[model samples]
Target: MFTDPIADYLTRIRNASRAGHRVVEVPASNLKKEITKILFDQGYILSYKFEDDQAQGSIKIALKYDKMTKEPVIRKIQRISKPGLRKYSGSEELPRVLNGLGIAIVSTSHGVMTSKQAKKEKVGGEVLCYVY
Candidate 1:
């Protein structure tokens, strides 16, 4: 059993990307599904699919890479709010990742969304992670 599934999810993707894997699979949960959607919508990932099985489902994510450089599009992905120490920010205080070049995923009351979206929606909640 994993104590911090979100962290594990991030690590799996990070490792896969560093290893030049075309796709990475992660154990799924509602929060993870929402995060995956946010990543896809932001164009960080090439594509994603959710598979439901008898036990917990899993997510298959096609990571993005630069056409010419052959470098992974996602240079970094870091967890913010962790199980040990939680991180929260208001819409007004939301962080601007890489000066708006990157995205910060937040879990607001409205739903799990990018920090920019949360700012536009005028709500705040736990800050999940930073992805670029």
Candidate 2:
């Protein structure tokens, strides 16, 4: 569940899809930047990282729900890890990769996940934004 303008914007997109309207893709270069601005203004994304040498990077984002916040205080943005990579078993193992990327993971009722986690969980929803 998202709030206000962003939520409304996504609704419009969804509605457009239902009505069979052609939707244009936002340019990739500005996609992360725009998301960062939105999340920063809304206090969702806390921080982020980017590197030329690193094919993989991560960002820390927060999940706000009815007065409860989880630990690590951040989350990572990386390629989805398959079940084979989960050495410890269970979603709990995800934090290790996130931590290695300088990300703090927050597990919520939504599930133990990250921006990358959503995909792994096969859960499709809006990506609130990126932190950096």
Candidate 3:
């Protein structure tokens, strides 16, 4: 049993990208699925698929890479809020990752969305993670 499934999800993608894996799989949940969608929408990942079975579903993510350099598109992905220490931020106080080059995923009352979207929507919630 994992204490933090979100952290585990981020770690799996990080490890797979570092290892140069084309496709990475993660055990999925509603939150994870939403996060995956956000990643796809932001172009951090190439593509993703959600597989539902009798038990907990799984997510298959195709990681993106630079064509010429053959480097992963996601330079860094770090979890912000944790099971132990929850980090919440208001729309006005949301972080600007990499001077707006990167994205901070937030779990807002509306739903999981990018910091920019949250700011535009005038909502606030837990700071999920940073991805660039």
User: Would you estimate the TM-scores of all the predictions?
Assistant: 0.98, 0.23, 0.98
lDDT value for candidate 2? 0.35
Q: Measured by TM-score, how close is model 3 to the native structure?
A: 0.98
Per-candidate RMSD vs. true structure? 0.7, 17.2, 0.7
How do all the candidates rank in terms of lDDT, highest first? 3, 1, 2
Error of 3 at 25 (Å): 0.6
Question: Across residues 1-132, which tens digit of lDDT does each residue of candidate 2 receive?
Answer: 333433333344334333433331221223334454444443543443332343433222233222353322223232222223421233433343423444222233464334355436744332332221
Separately for all candidates shown, the number of backbone clashes (residues 3 or more apart, or on different chains) is: 0, 1, 0
> Model 1, residue 53: displacement in angstroms?
2.7
Tell me which residue pairs clash in candidate 3. none
Query: What stretches of model 3 exceed 4 Å from their correct place?
Result: none
Regions of candidate 1 where Cα sits further than 4 Å from its true position: none
**lDDT per residue as tens, model 3, 8-94:** 999999999999999999998999999999999999999999998739889999999999999999999999999899999998999
